[model samples]
Target: MPAEEHPMIGVLLNGRTLRGIRRGSTQHEALQLYEHAAARLGCRICYFRLRDISLRRRQVKAIIPDGPVGRYVTRMIPIPSVIHNRAIHLTRRAQARLGRLHHLRYYIYNRHTRYSKWFIHQLLSKHPDIVPHLPETRQATPTAIHQMMERYDTLIIKPSNGSIGRGIMKLFKDGGRWHLQYRTAGMERTLRTRRGKRSKRRIRTRRWAVISFRSKLPAALKRLIRQRRFLVQQHIPLACYMERPFDLRVSVQKGDSGSWQVTGIVGKAAPAKLFLTNVAQGGTVYTLEHLLAANPSLHPERVRAEVERLALLIADHLDRHLPNLADLGLDIGITQLGFPMFIECNCRDLRYSFLEGGLWEEWAAVYYQPISYGQRIWLDRQVTSGTAN
Candidate 1:
């Protein structure tokens, strides 16, 4: 083994340049937290973009016992002690490349598996505590959608594989009519223009609806190689702040004691005229206390308890089923009755939410330093045996 590849304390973040990407605010927050944690732990951390780092499938397989099949099992990687997988948009080649490096003990805030998407849904479906918070939901299809439309006055169709609230649509029904509303590609405003006053004239300008026909989104997305399918969920008619919907983001990281902890909590309020509370759509984050206080109907303590419980539950569930996840950023929402619903569990790009004071201190103790040093011993033994043969 190379000297730099020694069993030293450090973290490897897997992704691209943080600035160029959309929805970078959350990414920047996470990167900063990881860097701070790495420093406090007396460890070095490096960032690698899976898209940039070239890898040959055959080469990665050569190091493992069952070859390519070992990826499904716990194997070792050629380099590094810990890997923080932050690759939000994974390419087919990148997925294959990372799968083979199982020996290095790559850590994810969420599980990266073929059924990872479905696993999230399963958690929501099984957990009675969180299920009541969710709106009426079902798998998406052409035939099943009409029933959803009938049940709910408004609905949302979202791409299962997407992130940062991209390719999400919000639908509304008025007078037995349906219209789609959404934010445009860029934050553009629609203003009525008139050179001079005309006698009772009407003008129509093209505007992107939050809810759009699947045909208008992109066919190129279908061409991208994927491990699984998409989902159609019931849109939660969120309690609004000035007529726009909002949601809460609770960031959770694994503590060094092999437990889950909530690092930060932020309530994301959507921009004016937008239904989604995604930060990419100019949403704002507020302190949990202030947010709950603003809405007197919600019980802040209960919501916090539920958030903490669900975070641990998801972390435990992922660790039980996948065993490789280190962190999870759960998107949760509150209904009028102060019920907490499960929006989604994002394992891919687990962003940090440090709304409270000294949030980094808590994060440093857990994520800054790795959880298990014992895994390294077994990895070394395997490498030694391979060399001996």
Candidate 2:
């Protein structure tokens, strides 16, 4: 902890990611992104978890990324003025702890990252400009589902806090019958006689299936909806590439000047047989330019402009309600006629999709943007308090 060192920006990860950093084996989040960003942005990175904070001492045992990759130094330093939250805090206790930190005058941007899908929809519904871009959404009650089915041929049922396309159900009615498409994770099997059996063996899983109902909504589906909070939305027909439906993942963030900007956009196409276009669920990523080139009918310039406009509008509107919503990954769909439709909003964006799409510069910019934004917050806090950052 040298005073001569550059100002530090804290990165708060979950316990598992913190341990992986100690072992130098974390794969999901590329630690090198921060290393390179530090060199370019002139701000060091301080990696810590909630448990690492010591309020009584007013300091934290933060990991400083120094030397080569997979190398760092641990020091008991005063908590950085700015923090970027990378962890999902779902429990009541976890949230209260974050609140405690906030009360201590810490600039924790994107601290409350996990907003429910239904909550976001409700907020955006009030904005006239953003309403047409949003699909029709309702709580997943049996009565609501029946009412929606009467109006729209297809609907989407998804968990309020789901991610990566998990816990999503697609429902469509055809020929006076209702069909549902969903996926199940690999099923588990138990072997009582472990001495003579393979206890780890599992049934073939991670496959998609469809169930049909003739006259009424299935009882099991109703029970599932009641067991957990779900939201139903009218399914928007998405533009297709290679005969498969696709959507865009737009990366929006506040830059050095604290203004929202669209940093990158990548195309996510559903698998040949699957309906969800999440990369975790057998989806493929393509550059927007490449996708537009393959589909000759889409006007690239118009589509790009509209997408940026909608993304910024959504970001600005959400920031008014959500505190410090500086970074977001929005899932927006495009119709055959080239209109941007809202799908979902992710507070803490995983920028890997840009890397997968082969947009190297955009991918790097995604990492560097946060550093620049954090620096802005740090500078502003100092000016407001008449002290150093």
Candidate 3:
């Protein structure tokens, strides 16, 4: 089939150079996924950085493969009918550039903030069903921290824009003192003996140190608060697997029918003694079935049904606010009492958890669903133009 016969679909990426033919590049991986789906859906797909688009020419200099298992070639193709954004970060300049291409539609619309806990809390607060799942959260002011600490036995202080469990501090009152635990880049530990008993090891590091301090509020924590804004959330006692804290990751995507559906749900277990279950933070992924088996006391079917229902509801609700959202990766924590808690939502969700759990079919669905949605948009445009003519 000729490329001209199909509507063009542009995959917006982060980098300047295109490496669709080179293995391990964002363009390469995206091209590989889009190529198969484009063939089936009858679309011409190309990978282009945001700067590659030319409004004057009404075309994009994109990296496109010559053929299957062939070299990559650059071509000035007509501006895409739709764009599937996979860029992790979009600058103001890039946003202005994309804004110029107002005629093209987008699957994943805008870059969402990682500090969106408070934003989402406010959005979901209107609905009673979702409110219970939201933990008590507030802007990390001194007063807010004091209030939260007074209310809850344990509190979590994390950066408003943090990811991969970075800049997170778990605080709890142990007897008369407050204890803070957090992860850092690298730290040296030394064992000291006090009164003929081995004392708790002390850790020293120049950078963000993974250590615990017993005091009212450490100087480091105060510096952290003074440096940038943070969020103080009431920590929930999440269920555990083999003594490691675990949480459920529900992947929801808009299907070809334009309805939200749960694509995959897997459990992520943190290393022992760790508070976070982020896979990037040395956490392990487990199948839902495995998680259910580990906790036989809870009804597996009931939990699965409830989680799916909640995930769909969240996706639908968020869609009202984010109209162009094609998919979401929801981090939901199931408490020991079997209550579901919303941890966070990722607009540009990482799909490696699905792949790690041997869910290739579901992972593939993530790539293909956007293409199908884009194809529908293209077909609608053609129909509208034809009818006008």
Candidate 4:
């Protein structure tokens, strides 16, 4: 390839981390993480503050588009060979800019689509094989929540566009009482509880603790225009390894053979009794095999094939529904009966961290290349059909 054609992979990160995530005057230890990964792939990462950047056509063209050669030479200007979306927060301006880019291969942790969670679940629901693994879910409204509570006493409320275990609530029956538990910072509190054992009752506050689809949905949609909506799901009894509720994260990547490969399996274990297992929320990570060995009762050997099956199932779903998706970070969990269930999938989730743990070689296959070879075919189709425009 000519010097000018040497695939320019531009990483658009928030400007807050140009030199990497810093504190006051000290560089964060985590900064090295992104830098090392970017160095390995020879990526020219540019951190742009989306709030400062607008979607105005003139501004977008000035910052992103190439010269006249890129504009008129091709009906659809070829996108940069690789666009690493490291954006933490999304604004309308950023979404508009991303929508205008026609020719680049871009990978986002989250998409710019409205009702993204609904779209993702819709695609996942279409897979017959995966249907059994997915927990029964529906849009949460005050009425729907009441209906779900009738069947299953416990329900997990999650912000559709949330990450790292923020804004998650668990409502369930505890002995003689109904309780609503949520997290703020790292500490947890039972914000409200309906009359239970009077002796154990501790704090009584005047704060109104209510979960409503009627109010939250509109506010969430506007507040997180770049993020997806919230989801209310039936809580699954996740398989436990080492006395902690364990969830499996299967990172899948597209291979040169045009098939999906299992990059790595990370078993996320929540600190005892917690309903969620996110690393950001005091969770521990372990290898799939190790966790299985510790929990003989889970009978992972019998379900191993199912894990691989779901990985491929998710890859196909992303390729079909979200045409721009190049890779998927699949969150899967196993119940006490050793039944595999789908938790979530993200397009921008990273795998290099798995590599640091010596999990598997597929980590290199997924993150090292930045863009999947198969996605190029989709890009070509988008250009030819003018859908990417």
Specify the highest-TM-score model's number.
2
Index of the highest-lDDT prediction? 2
Estimate, for each residue in 1-389, the C-alpha lDDT of model 1 and write its tens digit.
Answer: 44333333223334334332233443344444454554344343444444433244311111111212112122233333345555553467656656655543333333262334445677666766556655666655544566776677777766666667776666667665666664455543444547654435444443464333432333332332133354556777565665556677776666555556776677778887776677765677666686677777778898889777776776676566664666667788877666667787776433434432234554444345332321233245447653211
Worst 10 residues of 3 by lDDT: 106-115
lDDT, each prediction: 0.54, 0.88, 0.73, 0.57
| lDDT, candidate 3, 193-243, per-residue tens | 876666677776634344444535677777789899789998989888898
Q: Lowest-scoring 10 consecutive residues by lDDT in candidate 2?
A: 185-194
Which of the predicted structures, 1 or 4, would earn the higher lDDT when compared with the native?
4
Tens-digit lDDT string for candidate 4 (111-197): 432335556777889888778878888776656666777778788877776776777777776664556666533333344445543
TM-scores of all candidate predictions against the true structure: 0.68, 0.95, 0.86, 0.68
lDDT of 2 at 73: 90
| Ranking of predictions according to lDDT | 2, 3, 4, 1
lDDT of 2 by residue, 215-319 (tens): 588887888898999999999989998888899999999989899999999999999966789999889999898888877888999999999999999999999
* Candidate 3 Cα misplacement greater than 4 A, ranges: 16-21, 27-31, 103-115, 185-215, 386-389
